[model samples]
Target chain A: MANDTLQPALPTPESPASSVSTPQAGWVPMVLIGIALTFLALILYIPAINVFYQAFHKGIGPFLHNLQEPNFQRAVWMTLTLAAIAVPVNTIFGLCTAWSLANKHFRGRTLLLSIIDLPFAISPVVAGLMIMLLYGRQGWFGNWLLDRDIRIVFGLPAMVLATAFVSMPFVAREVIPVLEEEGTDQEQAAYTLGATPWQTFWRVTVPNIRWGLLYGILLTNARAMGEFGAVAVVSGNIIGKTQSLPLFVEEAYRNYDTEAACSAAVLLALLAIVTLILKEILERRTGGHLRKRH
Target chain B: MTATDHLPRTGTAPWQVFWHSLIHLPWTWRVMLGYLTLMLLLPTAALFTKSLSIGPAEFWRIATSPIALSAYDVTFTTSLIAALIDGVFGVLIAWVLVRYQFPFQKIIDASIDLPFALPTAVAGLTLATVYSENGWIGALLAPFGIKVAFTRLGVGVAMMFISLPFVVRTVQPVLMQMERETEEAAWSLGASSWLTFWRVLLPPLLPAILTGVALGFSRAVGEFGSTVIISSNTPFKDLIAPVLVFQRLEQYDYAGATVIGTVMLLISLLMLLVINFIQAWGRRYG
Candidate 1:
């Protein structure tokens, strides 16, 4: 089954390179690739150029001034705070969930896995709405929480909860497959050596899955930093208080402050570029490890 | 290392111990299940209940209103077109990145993920600025009378931008895993390149491509950040279902918002179900 599937996809010496080199074959595929690249470039290139042009048109002075804007600074601070809190909490939750699912053969295991994956399939906006219904003033648990004066719908709590909710599945998704593939041998060996459960987990299991965990955390941080739909619904978009960078950008765009919005967007683009770079490095390292194991 | 380690001690009764430990743990699967049920299932149930209480008559009246119907039309049509475009181009890009070695291959591969990491609101603002008549590429496309900003086309472009990654990412791994020997064998046997691709390569890829297209479609339909920014959001023209839902919620018409949201949810659920069925069938047969 595996050979049957694998054979056709990879190129081999027996296949004449003539097919790809033929003028007719080359033209169609090349044009198709060209058109695809053109479309993609159209989407990314223009906006990138616009940001650079706007930033440099007034030179570094105004650009730096814009960055120093108090709202921009606060937005960045809040975004960092949100990511710092959400990524670690979700990573821990994901680790626990992964351990349970991987080690235990409980009834409803499949159901539990599916439920854990539910957040990935559901819309972020829906996630925010779900939390709101549970914790909003007019929601089912809202009155009870309101009596205690706990606010979760329009502030940092809501933001963190929403971010965490959407991001929980990432670490688990990465770690579970690795755990399954690596098996329980090392863990059992540690247990046999009189290691307690915590000791075995910390000393034996975690090191093997640390790379996957870091990958998941990287993805989670990126998502948390950029999340807009869920945050928008729950944030109330209060200028410096509730607004993150994305929300601030949206507000600026809505109010027709195009330059300021572009400036904030450049910051976001820079973040995205950094994330892409980090992901590439991680993926390359992981790929190298896998190849060496093979 | 052996089954003995997993077995119960002579009198310890492992199953009982497991049950006891499970019960004692504060954060067990049961608790997690309860939390998820409360957070996800219950609110969705509320949305459905709210929709149901409005009755079919009220639903028909509200959902079929000219403005609402127009919004639905724009949303689905734009999403469908965008998904179609993304599927084709996304497949090509994935194919190139996986199958070819070229200058800047690493750069292109990394750039393909740029859309995934970019914030939708940021993408929206950037695209709007760049595609406006006064913007960079707009200057070139303007002479051709192609206006991308503040139009339905602009909405489609934004949706395509955000969704392009879904298709490529979904398909690329499958492409990479496929072996080339079969194609070589076919070629040695005198099969044409097109024939080999059509008979061998395309079959396994169809399922993954379809899955990606479906994901892109659903994402485009639900998109709000970029669409709202780039498009005018004028009623009956550029407004999408999610945006309309937000507008209703902003107006404090909870019932109305829930109804609209429920309708969208139902449609998306149905679409996804169909796509999944196709995926299963493709995997089985293709």
Candidate 2:
């Protein structure tokens, strides 16, 4: 962290070292910073605090009642189940992809890296449309599956796919940087000592990247649980059968169930705050290795 | 270090050859390629295939239709405005985070990423509530004849909320890693502070700022959850492309939805490429 004094003129962006001995910055920079911080406080801080405040403003009884509603309950369960399935799958996908990406030499490697981030760069709605194009009743594979009386679109499978797609990049994005920064020396050393690749990975690689991996998984779980647009498109927003927590929030808000919507939003906001806390801890513990990219 | 730095430095070493062969195995390739192809590559390909089936003429017709064009206009213009606003404030916020310590600093820093971690729909709901006519911020501005919740302004607010973290995160790291001695050296050389910043500091920061701008822009463009809830969703007004795609899907116009989606995909991919390029450039220079 820097002192309020913006001393010694503007520093080059992206340097990690802090300067406590630098001269204090002029009042001009202080005024600018004051305005910026104030605006930020109004925008990001106020509304977030308001979510929790309003959720409980009327009383915990209303919040509890909203929580007990079957629709809300089902949405919570569906959200958790989606995360349960999506996180592990994407985590594995991320591990394999990161392992190959960080360790391998092959053509189209850059292409693969970009592809991994495709989910992040693409709109979630577009992601859902892509899935629907694949699995809808008249879709390429959908027609074939229809022949066998299968239902993917407007179902749990579709929701899972949508969630998985949106969260695909998290673990790999986090792990790749750490692995790249840490290098492959230990893996190579393990191989020379007659360790199998899997053994070497479990023993050397995983431990080295444990914090980064957990951070990535934490982020993946957050996104998986909170994904809205893609799931909304593919799940058809069916109240009980397909509604995830986010969809439920949207529905509850639209239907003027302000209590229910605010409560649900508060729950998700709490999850997000928890995610941020854990991330901050991991980042400090790891000395911010998780923030690097190459 | 470049990604290729991790590659075996000497190609002739036995260990290096063995490692290459292992990574080159069908199993490794399958695990990497298979998952992506199934989850990402194939589905995206299917989307393009579906969209292309409508042919260029029909695709052009739908993409350029009056309503679609209006939706595109709303989406792009508001996103650009939001990204621009974020560009300025994001740098300010990042600077404050890097250059100043304040009370609740950790809490504020942690909360910056609330947008990233929080559900977008939840953001939309909360934002709509707070900015609606009778709501807190809305009520304050209601006397001024400013309507936010159901207009393009609300859409921009939603986009800004979700995309703010992008600029702050991108620029903050660069600012943190900045060498203070460069500015000190310039000051020692008798250069004015403003001149030193303009001549020395601004050059390297530009690429990073551009990268942040591009990322925020793309994120805003692709935004759906919040905008869908905040905007009126009426075409030729605040309606955005993503909502239009959703609306088309709801109407069972799968082809129309796919076409709109395809347009979004192409534009986003282009923007992402630009962002990645600028980031790489920043890494190289900054």
Candidate 3:
């Protein structure tokens, strides 16, 4: 664990950028790798495996039984609906923001960038508080909403808003860097060739950033599906009505239905695993394309 | 023709020129700002107004109440401890992944982000299960009398889990971008491995490590879902600030909740400023 990177790093006389291709540092790298792996196994891998093992420990009977619960089904539907709404909304905003940021330089540009990143830095719990402050009864717009007979908090609308806020920055964050790297040269060329702004965006810019956009959408979807803290605050954790899968796990555990909780968790864990695998593929794919383009 | 073709040629007012140029951009900045305001800015502004509507004296009292202070203590101390732990192991993990050759490496590299993708509620459940007295790892430590789950230690573990990826991801790129000739130069000059590391490697990497630690600390401080479940939520013991905010909200003490939320918001924003400053410093020096 100590000085793991301090190897006998002798890059073969001017082997351009391939810093010490071979590890001849004997047992050091091996020992370091072992320590790191052991640490990760205890902290991450073992805990992750525990989720699946606990889910099916009572055999497939209870696992399937837990999944068949109506609330569980509702929770799954609610989660997908939230993701379906939040991901596309943010994806479009991400594209628009990326295009605007990439196509021009202006005052407050850094400020705008920072604002896009605000939701990420914010605590999900506080994010809920903000929304509640705005839309809850006795809130700033409480009278207006009450006059209109609207219930925003403790319902699907606020849940969607909270989910959107928490996952909002992902698409923009992922796409901005890619667009900045690609620059506006291609878009300008398309415009000079008499293409409309939308045409230039769809034909030239979108193709160039499709992988990045997909990467962002993948993260946004996974987060929207898995968001617990913010959604918990805003959704009121209503059993069959507002409970997303993550909330269902909490409620099930609270009810001493460990099997149900673990089963629902397994579903989310599967989603996360899928997200991770796709993320890896995108990173590798983007890496290859980025190298070629540059 | 493009939007600029209609611009008045001779006496274009400055404001008119600004508006015309803005409209002619490939994307509409209006919609971008409008969305940004509606989604992020407006809600945040509401929180500020609501929280600050109460006079400063009262706001200060609520934010620094004994219970609130204790929660902040647990939140900050535990998060700092977790982030420091991550700093050590995260660097080691990044080092091994970047410099060493090993099998299943790519999968492990990707898995560092598991905490980001996996729901925290699931993480909390599993951690509680695995660290309970009769649980897998807990059973081994039971005889030693070190309780983990349902304690502050459990909260720290949860924080550590979520914050691990930040440090690794930040430092990994910096480590990869480093020049090897400096280290080779030091080695060729008869510097010991430890000395070469301290003198040649670490100085350049310090800013990145600090930035990662700051980001991780901010993240851990804001963490709610997992810590809420892992900790018993005892007021003066293991409770975190975010959990405290939830408790206040649950009790319908909106004022109490908003005050604490504002304090946490300010601290998290301060952390961000510090991170940005560190990155700028690193860019200039490293």
Which candidate number maximizes TM-score? Answer: 3
- In order of lDDT, best first, we have 3, 2, 1
In model 3, the Cα lDDT at residue B52 comes to 72
Q: How many clashes would you count in candidate 3?
A: 0
lDDT by residue (B1-286, candidate 1, tens digit) is 2313544456767787676655655464564555566556786776676677789899888888787888899999999999998998888888877765556767877887787788888888888888888777777889999999999999999999988888898888788778766766667566766777789788888888888888888888878778888998889878887788777767767666666777777776777677668768877874
Better DockQ candidate (1, 2): 2
Against the true structure, what is each candidate's TM-score? 0.87, 0.91, 0.92
Identify the superior model by DockQ, candidate 2 or candidate 3: 3
Local error of candidate 2 at B283, Å?
A: 4.4
C-alpha RMSD between model 1 and the true structure: 5.3
Candidate 2 whole-model C-alpha lDDT, 0 to 1: 0.86
* Candidate 2 positional error at B275, Å: 1.4
lDDT of each: 0.77, 0.86, 0.87
Give the winner by lDDT. Answer: 3
Among incorrect, acceptable, medium and high, the docking class of model 2 is: acceptable
Winner by DockQ: 3
Off by over 4 Å in 1: A1-33, A103-108, A288-294, B1-31, B52-60
lDDT of 2 by residue, A1-294 (tens): 444244544554333233322234456566866888777866787788779888999889999988899988999999999999999999988888788788666677787788788888899999999888889987888879998998999999999999999998999989988899889888889999999998998999999999999999999999999999999999989898899999999998899988889999999999998998998999899987777221
Worst 10 residues of 1 chain B by lDDT: B1-10
True contacts kept of 3: 0.63
Q: What is the interface RMSD of candidate 2, in Å?
A: 6.0
Better of 1 and 3 by TM-score: 3
